[model samples]
Target: MTDPNKSLWTATARPAESDETSHETLHGTHRTDVVIIGAGFTGLTAALKLAEGGAKAIVLDSVEPGFGASGRNGGQVIPGLKYDPDQVDQMFGEASTDFIGRAADTVFELIDKYRIDCSPVRQGWIQPTIKQAHLPTLKRRLLQWQNRGCNAEWLDADRMQKLTGSPCFVGGWIDYRAGSLHPLNFVQGLARAATDAGVTISSQSEATSLQRNGDNWIVKTAAGAEIIASQAVIATNGYSGSLLPKLRATIVPANSFQIASEPLSESQLNEILPTRAVVSDTRRLANYFRISPDNRLMLGGRGTFSEPASLKDYGKMMADRRMLFPQFPDLKVDYAWSGRIAMNREHLPHIHQPMPGLTMALGFNGRGVAMGCSIGGAIGEHLLDSRVRLPLPFSEMKPLPLHAWHPFYATLAIWYYRLRDQLEN
Candidate 1:
C-alpha cells in the first residue's frame, strides 16, 4: 500500500539550498496595494509580478507554499488550453487566438527568467493515440495547432516507438514547446522569487471572509488577522472554499491521483522513455507518465470523483499502470497522493471580476500548471493596469445551475467516461 500522506515529488524533490523568504505568520491588521489569497503557483506568480512592478503585494495561504495542486500536479508544462486550437478559435473567435497562443509560451519564459531549479527538461511532450479510433482526433488536434502557427510535429508509429521506447502507442504528435518539470520545486522557486521581490507571503493564514470597506477590500483570516487592500485576487483554484460562496459554486473540484514507483535500474530506464519526455495517452480518462530526474516512474490519471480515504484504495490505478507498461509489470509503487482539479463545464479557464476590486482566475481544468503560471502574470498585469488586455476574456461569474448537485453529476460523468473508455478499447 502506498502512503497517502507523502507524494513522490515531496519525498524525492531536492530541498531548497537556501530559502530567503521569511515564513512569517499573519498577525494584526495590514494594508497592501494588492492582497492575493492562496500561495499556489497562480498566487505566487501574481505576487512576484506585482512586486517586480513596484506593488506592495501580500499573499496569504492556509498552508505552506506549494501545498496544493501547484505542487501536486504531473508537472507537464503543456502549452495551450484543454480545448484544441480550432475549438478555441471557434468558441472565442479568431481574434482571441493570438493572445491564447502567446499565453502558452509565457510559462517557459517565466521558468527561464527566474532560473527555477525544478529539473525542467525541454525535450517536449507527446499525446499518443492509444487506439486507431483516436487517430482522427489526434490529426485534427495537430492541424488545429499548426493552423495557429505552433511548431508541432506528427509522429508515426516508428517515431513514437523510437521516442517512447514502447509499442503501446500507434501514433502521436510532439509539441516541442511543451516540457516537464518538478512541480513542487517550481512552485517553491516562484515563492522564493516572489519574496525576493518584496512580496509578503503569510503561510497558515486562511482567509475566512471577504468584505468591502469603502474603497478597499477587507480580507479576514481565521486567526483574526485582517488585510485591507485596494485590490484583491482570489487565486485559490481547486481548494477554494466558502470564503467566497458564489465563486465556490462556479466550478467543481475533481480529484486526480498519482503514483510513483521506486527508482528503476539503468537498464529498465533505457527501455522506457529513454529520451525522458512526458507522455500522455489519448483517452477520455487519460493516463500521463514520465521518468523523474532520479529515475522513478511517475504515473498519474483521473481517479474517483470523490477523494479516497487511503492510497490502498487505488488498486485500479496500479492495475492500469501495470497494463500500460507490461515491461515493468513488477513495478512497486512507493508513493501515492491525490489533489483536487478545478473543472468547468466548458473545460477552459475562467477569468472574471465577479465584483469591483475582486478578480479571480480558476477552472484551468487539468492544465493549471502552465496555464496557472501564465494567467498569474496576466492577473498581475491586470491588477497593476486595468486597461491591459487579458489573454482570456473576463466574464461575470456564472454559477453552475443546481451547483449543489455537482457531486452527483460528477460521479455519473466519471462512470460514463470509464465505461466509454472500456468500450472504445
Candidate 2:
C-alpha cells in the first residue's frame, strides 16, 4: 500500500543536486536588481532568465524550491490556458490571445534548450470525452487549436479507447504539442540553472511584509532580513499569504489531490495507456492521469476545497481513480498527496501590476505547469526592458466578491460540478 501522507514525487523522485544546496534563512539586509517571492517554477524561471541577461536576482521562498504546486502537480505539461481559444479571444482580444497562445509552447522549448533532465515525454496530451454531451466541446476545442495552426486532431470513440486503453471515454481530442514531465525534477533543474546563472536563492525566508522606498521596494522577511530591489515579482500563486492580502484575495485556492499506484507489471502497463500520452477527461470535476517514467500510474483530480487533514480524506479521489482505470482492479496505491490550485473567476491566468515596480502573476486555474514557466519568462523580459510587451494582457488587480467565504463556496461549487458531471454523463 502507498504511504498515505507522502507525495509520490517527493518519495520517489531522484533528488536533484539543487536540493542539496544549503539555503540559509535570510538574516540581514540584501539587495538585488529584482526580488522574486516564491521559488516555484515561475520564480525560478524568472531568476534564470534575469541572470542570463546579466541582472542580479534574489529569490525568497517560505519553504524549499518546488515545494508548492510546482512540485505537487500532476506533471502534465498542457499547452494553452484553461479557457478555449474563443473564450480567450472574447475575454482578452485576438492579439493578446494569439500572443499568449504562442508563448504556451515555451515550456518544452525551455526543457530542450536547457537540457533539463526532467524525463519529459512529448507524446502529446489527450482530453477524452466522458459523456456524449462532451463531444461538441471537444470538437470545438480541437477546431480552435486547428485554426491556430496547432497539430490538433479529433478522435472518435474507437480511437479514444485505442489510444487510452480504456472504454471510459466516448471521444476526445489530442494536442500534438502537449506532453508530460516529472514536475519536481523540472523545477529543481530550473533552480540549479538559476543558481549556476548567478541568482541567489534563500529558502525558509518568508516575506512577511512589503513596503515601497522611493523607486525601490523593501520586502521584509520573517527572519528579520529584507530584500531591497527596484522591481519585485510576487510569484507565490496559491500560497500567496498576508504579504499581499489583496493579491491573495484575487484567487480562490482550491485543493487538488492525487494518488500513485505501484509500478505495474510490464504486461499490464502495455495494456494500459499504451500510447504513454497524458490524459484527462471532459468533466468539470475532471480526472487527469498518466503512467509515470517508472511505470507507476498517477491519477489526480479535484479534491476538497480545503486541504485534507489526512490521506484517508482522499477516499473519494481514490475511488474515482479505480472507477476510471478498472483495468488496474488490483492496483496497489503507493502514494497520496494534495496541493492547492489558484482558481480565478475568469478561468484564466492573470497578470497584474498592483503597483509600479511590482508585477504579480497567478491564477493559472489548473494549467500552471507550462503557463507559469511561460509567464515567468515574460516577466523576466519585461523586467529587463519595460518596453517589452507580455503576451498576457496586464490588468489591475481585482479581488473577488465574497472572498472571505471562498473555502465554503469553493466546496459548494465542487459539489455542484460533481452533480452536473454525473447527470450529464
Candidate 3:
C-alpha cells in the first residue's frame, strides 16, 4: 500500500536534525516525571512546555514526528472552534470564547519563539461563502469576532474576488489572526525544540498498555520497553487505538484528502490567491485551499470512509478543484495524500483525566494545527500546577453510542452532506 503519510509537506519539508535524533525504537526501562504517547503537535507541545517548566518528559510515538495528521493536515492555522463565539460561550461559558479567540496566536508565537523555519505566512485566512444563504452566518461570525477585538473583516463579492481570484464566492470574511505554514516542518521544529529543551523522544515505540504502578504510571511499549512516570498523557488524536478502547471509541476517525498542483508561474499565481491568504469555503464538507511556500496550489476536503490505495481515488477532489478554478483546467497534479481527523459528536475538543496522573486530549475536529497546540500548552500548564485552569472543561469519557458502527454511519452522513452541498451550489 502506498503510504499516505508522504504528503506534500513531507516531500518538500527540509530535513531536521531533531527528527534524526528522536527517531529510535524504545527498549529497556526508562523513567520520567511525565510520559507522553503520540508525538504529534499536542504531545510535542506538551513535552516542550513540561521540559521548559523543569519537568522531565519522555515522548513515545508509533511513528516519527508529523507521521500523523499534524504533518499531513491542510496547514491552515485556523483559530477558534467549529462553533461561533456566542455558541462557545453558551456551551462552555465566557472564558472558553476568550481562549479560543486567541488559539491561532499559539501557532505563530511558537514559531517565533522557537525560530522554527516552517515557511510561516501570516497574511490571514478567508472563509468564503459557498452559497448565498451562508452570507448572514458569515456576517454574524465576522461581527462576533470583531466584538471580541479580533482582526476580522467582511469581504463583499468584489473584494473576495480581488483577494481569492475566485468569482464563484459571493461574499465572505477574513480573520487576520489565522495563517498558514509548512505543517510537517512546524511539527518537526516542535520536536527539535522539545529535544533541545531536555525532553527525550522515541519514535516507533507504540505504547501497548498503561497501568498504575505504585505512585507512578507504567507504560509498556510494543518493543517490550517500559516507562514509569508520575504522570502520563495520551496524545494520539485520529490515530488513537486500543491502548484505551474507550478513548478510541470516543471519536470517529474521518479521513481527509488533499492534492497539490505543480508550482504555478507568476501569472498563474497572481490569478489565484495573490495575497497568499489561505481559504476554506462555508460548506458542510468544507474545502480548504492555499498556495504553498513553493507556489503550488493545494486543495483538500473530506475523503472516503475507507483508506485510499492510490492517487486514482482522488478523482472527485480533482474534479472539485477544476470546478472551483476552471481557469486552471489543465493544472498538473504533483502530489496527493490523506490522513485521519478525529471528529467528536460535540465538534469540540475533549479533555479527560479518566484517572489521576493521566491526561487524554483529542478530537480537534479538523482544527488541530491551532487548537491542538493551545490545548496541549494548557494541559502542560495544568500538569505543572494543578490550580491552572484548562481552556475546555474536563469531561467524562463518554464513548459515542454505537461507536462500533461509525463507518456505516459516517458513509451515510458524507453522502447526505455531499448531496446537500450540491443542492446549495
- How much lDDT does each candidate structure score? 0.85, 0.86, 0.91
TM per candidate comes to 0.96, 0.96, 0.97
Count backbone clashes in candidate 3.
Answer: 0
> What tens-digit string does per-residue lDDT give for candidate 1 at 1-425?
55686887788776666546555888999999999999998999899989998999999999878988998999888887767787777888775666666654677777788888888887788999778898988899888888777888999999898888677889989887788889998888899889889999999999998999999999999877899999999999999998887898889998889888888998988877888879888888898889887888888888887677786677777887887787778888888899999988888889888678889999988888888888888889888888987777888798898888988988899889889988884
lDDT of 2 by residue, 1-425 (tens): 55565787887676556445666677888989999999998898888889999999999999989888999999998887767889878887887667566654688788887788888988889999779987888898899889988987988989888888777888989887888888888888788788878999998889998899999999999878988999999999999988888999999988888988888898878777888899988789989989988888888899877566766787887788778777667687788888988998888788899788899999988898888998898899989988988877788799999999998888889889889998985
State the displacement of the C-alpha of residue 342, model 1, in Å, after optimal TM-score superposition.
0.4
- Candidate 2 regions with alpha-carbon error over 4 angstroms: 18-20
Model 1 ranges off by over 4 Å: 17-19, 93-95
Q: What are the per-model C-alpha RMSD values against the true structure?
A: 1.7, 1.7, 1.6
For candidate 3, the 10 contiguous residues with the lowest summed lDDT are 15-24
Backbone N/Cα/C clashes per model: 0, 1, 0
Top model number, TM-score: 3
